[model samples]
Target chain A: MKSLHAQHHPLADTGYQLTVLTQAEVEGAHQPLFATRLREAGLLPLRPTGITVMQVNVGKMCNQTCRHCHVDAGPDRTEIMTRATMQQCLDALRQTPIEVVDLTGGAPEMNPDFRWFVEQISALGREVIVRCNLTIIVANPKYYDLPEFFARHRVRVVSSLPHFSAVRTDAQRGEGVFGRSIKALRMLNEAGYGVEGTGLSLDLVYNPSGAFLPGNQAALEREFKQRLVREHGVVFNSLLTITNLPISRFLEYLLDSGNYESYLDKLVQAYNPVAAANVMCRSTLSIGWDGQLYDCDFNQQLDLLVDGRAPQHIRDFDLAALNERSIVVNQHCYGCTAGAGSSCGGATT
Target chain B: MEKATYYNPADLAKFGNITEWQPEMGRKFFDYYGEVFKDGALTEREKSLIALAVAHAVQCPYCIDAYTTDSLQKGADEAQMMEAVHVAAAIKGGAALVHSVQMMNKAKELSM
Candidate 1:
């Protein structure tokens, strides 16, 4: 609380080194950690209680540079998941009880072997989800066949469109992104996603266009449903209204826009015990592009790698070990527990 | 260290000092107050907008400062939040206006 104007400065230039200062703030803040807040509400630090979702960052290589991209992904980003790392993730999946393999990245599909990876994940009988940036679908010719490919594998697609309005979507993501996203959504619809009985689920993600948290999940879903169907003839199974976590690009936005202190205060003030109890960290395992592990994707983004005793990397994954280690937490975690709470899949509460 | 003004923006952060003066009751109140805002029958956003409206009527700079941020954090747009304040203003004004019937009744009784 000692004038965190210093700590709240964007780490745009510093990269992962911000992790150290983040930890210090978590330790020294007058407010308690979200973990401690949870404990006070009777939810104590337990092991990776139950890992149902294994989120693997395939790489940071992305086609578009969204303002709030937590992955720091962009076209120039060279880091990518190699075949070996992908195989290791597959190996970990085979050995563990994880039934959902969530693939994320600058653009998960941008990887050369992305198709091979999805096919393999499906072969393991795991539910595969791609955290797609919709623009990727229409970004290039190589991606043109994605709709057909996704349908064949029955891959669950979760893409961020931000809003039903093109101006809003394009404003946050980039110019021309809204057009590409609508085209991509229609293509996914053509492939049977969000259709009545096809079982190929196509979920859309909606994070706020700015520093604020997202509105109510169910209501926003309805509005998005009506607008998309009415205006674009697009359909989707469900919509996830996510609270933007203060990390990476979003943290930069808050700092740059002078909302950093107030935003953090707002997150702390709106802490919901119920949402904190059901946080995604309690049930998910996050894997970095390099196979390093984390409690969640936000933690992965910070490179706050999982605890010391836990299997630090997918290659060394031991369920029992991970199950016993306490989750790593910091101030940024307030984002996940604020209001209805947010996770990769959406609000927990 | 009481200031002449009853409320100061800086005092919002130091609101925690209330506990130092009265630990037992202060701790109890803070705990109960936090529980009131959890996602329940009404969402946190709904609660925030309501809080914003109340802040206006109560005229507590601290509550107003807190709830304005809370309203935004809960994704209430500037326009919607301003509307909430307007709702508060109308309600506050109506409460006073409605009470004026008593003044009219007193005048009628005096004349009779």
Candidate 2:
């Protein structure tokens, strides 16, 4: 297994760094066969449950390059959502009756027009969800007031903290991310984001530091609340445990570490039919930074467009046709349906 | 025809296949097994740690394989997990040594 970092070829015309491991390559690792499992579980030909979430990936630019980052986002990555594309997504959001405007990126806050984007979404009176990497607030002095800004617009902030302890969190993110994240959580608390009655919600996302399905979400949330409060005196509304999809840098790690096949086997073996039925793609319409449509963010990253003859661009969004279109899924979908399950909001079943 | 080996670590994944031999009993056993792991008095993670320790004490390779992965997935660190194994080893060794008292009593009775 050679490093995909140095290997080249197959760049998207959009100039986004293309995944060396194609969809087929990612699917090659499947053991029990994701589709067969779905069919046996009576879950084939999965269709939308009506889109309620408009998940928008603003860009691939971030302050930290997490080892398991499915986005492969870092400071040097130039792929970002232009104001035009952002406008397109906003227009689609306005035209469609979608409720939650979910925003994500390398460090979505790193986008130059991120504040404007959040403000515009806020003005629509739609609930805004910002997938903030907690370190970004402490990474730069200019971003220090983000908690206040987030509170101002009543945005739901979901930040990633791979573990409660510094060792595991820093192992997954960078060396000092844990300390910085704790500081940022304190900042968010000060701004009343996670306060008992502020009406502003602050949540933490937990993904496994290695190649395994996430544990039970409710159980882990209790552990996180206990440890974060007991040790740092910080509190948050909830914890969202997301299973890392095998894509981007994480795929590379699996390959490099020789754990790809075994991990994929584990996912397939642990597949829950209930979880497969309730995958997030059923209720989420994901829009890429370049305004391309996808069934979910993982599909967006892999460049798997929504199925059939639907309009692929946000500007041309047709809610009826989009709702009627079948969601595109592949072996990677197992990551979402394994065990208690995982999704953007948290576990599925 | 060949008889199946008593324990094969690979058979851990095939535990569900026991239903192939005796569907009624296998299904019932698994139903109860699944129910036991659900969150209740003890969290699933705590159960996993306990399972890991018992796997060592019982020297069941299959249980060890399954529960080691389970413990890690449930957020048990290497130290915590290893400490659990040590607890099982300590109890097992203590249990074995305490039985020496029976051997001492038998020798005394025979000599008297």
Candidate 3:
């Protein structure tokens, strides 16, 4: 079935096929439904909503240095959140009613005060999210009980699993990473994280290991469910289909491989306005490890701060002011606004 | 599943044959491809950088090799290219971390 799908959609590699025509293209062709759908999805192009979602960059430390890792994170990275920053984050939380607190870093778990920050935010009863690299739980014996710790605090755990197959996953994340991730998922599932009727949501994330954007999220979710259940007895709540942003190490890989032009064309042609209108940065607040603020994690890394009178660092967080501040964007912003739109959470559209 | 040959730099440099299965689509892509590389909303250099960054994010060896050269040719220095790749890494990393909520919630349900 996968092979058949690949055959029909030849753009599976570079994702640069012109499958859907524009209204102009159809006026010159026989088929028009494809063109109509493209128009409805706003793939034809237009600027969409611009809003601020405070972004924090906790640090540059990570447990895995996957092939496509944009952060260039590894154990070598010493940058991390200071205790002072954690206090700032808490202060911001207290003053701001931001819908989401997006805590990120090399591995947010690697931060010394990761749990404390989660505890504080959860105590305030705000939606607190922590980006977890699944292998971190198994990276060291000290972190073996992270599943329990995260559960105790009600912190949402978002993990990366590029594919259900071990080969593909290991290829990207390094040897043994896939096995540890699966073991971690089983641990999460046994705890009722991905099972039906459980509010404990365990949503797996996938990006194409190549140049293409992922196929339909719902369909891929079904395929993942079947494969995982049959092969590994794994289960998860949903699958987030994300387009790979053409920035960072991934960009290096593209240039090194001679696919730069083709891939960019794919992203440009696939731009979906619906995705742009609901981009995640509009609703999510990102906090750096030291409590500095940005519009999103992407902008945070670029050192693009929010514009307004609010505290730049978490130490002086004023939620109302930050929320009212305008977001800083660049051409890279198109990545989040293109096709189905991508965010840490999933497809915004 | 067909066993695919993963290319190294040496092998990739020798790569030249374009697949001929979709002649029409391939020609169309080439035409649009030319226009896309032209400076518009995105400059040619900017597009090259974006592609290089995405190649790493997607972990495509072929793309990584191709775009690295394209970015450099288009005047993107090593630092700019590295910075772009870092952007991809952060987003990818953040995406993974955000989903941990499932594990936390599940652990709570079972522990209780």
* Winning model by lDDT: 2
Q: What are the runs in model 2 whose C-alpha is more than 4 Å off?
A: A1-44, B1-8, B17-32, B93-112
Order candidates by lDDT, high to low: 2, 1, 3
Where in model 3 is the C-alpha error above 4 Å?
A1-55, A308-311, B1-112
Model 1 Cα displacement at A309 (Å)?
Answer: 0.8
List model 3 lDDT by residue over B31-92, tens digit each. Answer: 77778877678766678888888899999898897787666434344567889999999989
Least well predicted 10-residue stretch by lDDT in candidate 1 chain A: A1-10
i-RMSD values for every candidate model: 3.9, 1.3, 13.8
Docking class of 2: medium
> Taking the tens digit of each residue's C-alpha lDDT, what string does model 1 give over B19-95?
99899999999998899988789877778899999999999889998897677555555667889999999999999
For residues A176-221, write the lDDT of model 2, one tens digit per residue: 8899999999999999988898998999999988877778788888
Poorest 10 consecutive residues by lDDT, candidate 2 chain A = A9-18
lDDT of 1 at A187: 85
Q: In model 3 chain A, which range of ten residues has the least summed lDDT?
A: A12-21
Candidate 3 local lDDT, A1-349, one digit each (tens)? 1211223433222222222212224456332232243357654332223333344567778877776665556776678988777776667666655555666678888888777777777788776666677888877888878777777766666778877767667866778888999988988887677778766767788866666566556656766787788989988888887667665556656666877656665566666767666777666666666566667776665555666555577666565665566555554565676667788877787
- Model 1 interface CAPRI class: acceptable
RMSD of every prediction: 6.7, 4.2, 20.3
Cα lDDT tens digits, model 1, A240-348, are 9788888877777777798777677778887998887788888899998888999998888787888898889889989888878888877788888888888888888
- Show pairs that collide, candidate 1: none
